[model samples]
Target: MPNLELLAPLAAALLAAGLFAGLLAGLLGVGGGIIMVPVLYYVFGLLGVDEAVRMHMSVGTSLAAMIPTSIRSALAHRKKGAVDEVMFRRWLPGIALGVLAGVLTAAFVKGPVLMTVFAVFALLVAVYMAFGKDSWRVASELPGRLGQTIMAFLIAAVSVMMGIGGGTFTVPTLTLFGYPIHKAVGTAAAIGVLIAIPGAIGFILGGLGEPGRPWGSLGFANVVGVLALIPTTLLAAPWGVALAHRLERRWLRLAFAFFLAATGIKMALSLLGA
Candidate 1:
């Protein structure tokens, strides 16, 4: 068994992270993967986990932990009529396929590569969110069937790879096409469910029996981390959902943008050895 001394501190840290993640999930339509990924990676490092398996574990654990948070967040938005049901239903097929591709890619890729992918994409989305306007119209509306499917696939793939949900990419994409930000955020929360379920499974299978895993690991997902995260996230998510509904759209956009930019830059710099 792992030392209780170490596990105790780790558990405390994860609980704190979970609370913050819950807020983001409900308020910003994320699955909390963005926050969890880096936090897990760092915690795993302290546990002396191998570099090879550390990042993958972080991603897997984040995905697994995100499931309930996403569900709760999505349901809250659904109740508010902010979710776009038609779009969400149409995107399901593409999202599942994308999750498969993304998980496969993550399984084979290096830790730094995954970090870079997450960092660069996050920066790009943050830029768009910061400067882009509500009047922006990429195609005067969301695309037709083929385009929507393709975009959905791309969004899911990127989100899974980055250990994020649809919010990091989807919200901006929808806004560019003239969808209201609230609707985009709500829809993204639902899409996160589609990505995380299969994606977590893939990570588990991929990392099963891999060397240098931490204590309480079932494949790449850490049981302690997952368990520690869930309850706090569940408790705090409703508060964020309530906040989301009351906040102005512009403020919401700015808050999300700033958070992404700071997190993305820090991750990118750390990866680059700066």
Candidate 2:
């Protein structure tokens, strides 16, 4: 039997993380997986989980947790007609291929290296979110098929390694290409569902039979973590969607940028032993 006593604290922390993750999913199209990875990693460490697989477990479990939240957020956004169907279709094939590659990358890359990359990337995106003008555009339209495939691949792959749902990359990339922020956020929410599904499956397969995982883990995903996070995340996500619709686009972007900057800085500081 699992030890409920030891699990209580982890459950508490997971619930809190879920709340934030859900809100961000709706508000900024981020699946909250980015934040959840670090939280799960720390709590798992305190639980005596093995260091070798701790990051893997964190990434996998976070991907699993994101499934429901992203779905919920997507549905809420769709109801408001914020989702851009044309862009979603154009982006789907590449997103699929990229998700597969990303899952594979996560299997081989070292955790610290991935974290550093994530931190640098987040900071860069944050800068754009904070200051990029509406007129800024790489082109008058999104790239042609080949270029889009590569960009989509990179977005999905990087997001998987970082335990995110690809929104962190997608939203800014879309906005940079002249898509409206609201449309970018909503479309990204739907795309997150795709990223999380395959990413979760890949992690589960990758971690099969691996030792030193937490109790109740199926591969790297912990049943307790998924369960504890889901309810609150489902509850909070709709609230965030409503609020995001109410807020001005500029304010929403600024708030999201601030949050990303803080998360990235905190991760970078961890590398310096801070």
Alpha-carbon RMSD of each model: 1.9, 2.3
lDDT of 1 at 241: 85
Cα TM-score of candidate 1: 0.92
Tens-place lDDT per residue, model 1, 173-204, is 88889889789989998898888888888888
Q: Where does candidate 1 stray beyond 4 Å?
A: 249-259
Task: Summarize candidate 2's per-residue lDDT along 1-274 as a digit string, tens digits.
Answer: 5567977877898899889888878887888887788788878877888877888888899999999999999998999899988778887888898888888787787667767877888788778879977677876677888887788888988898888999888887887787887888899999999899989999999889988898889987887788988888888899889887787668767876797799789879977889
Error of 2 at 246 (Å): 1.0
Off by over 4 Å in 2: 1-6, 129-135, 249-266, 269-274
Whole-structure CA lDDT of model 1: 0.86
Q: What is the C-alpha local distance difference test score of each model?
A: 0.86, 0.84
On the 0 to 100 scale, the lDDT of residue 114 in model 1 is 87
**Candidate 1 — worst ten consecutive residues by lDDT sum?**
247-256
Index of the highest-TM-score prediction: 1
For model 2, how big is the CA root-mean-square deviation? 2.3
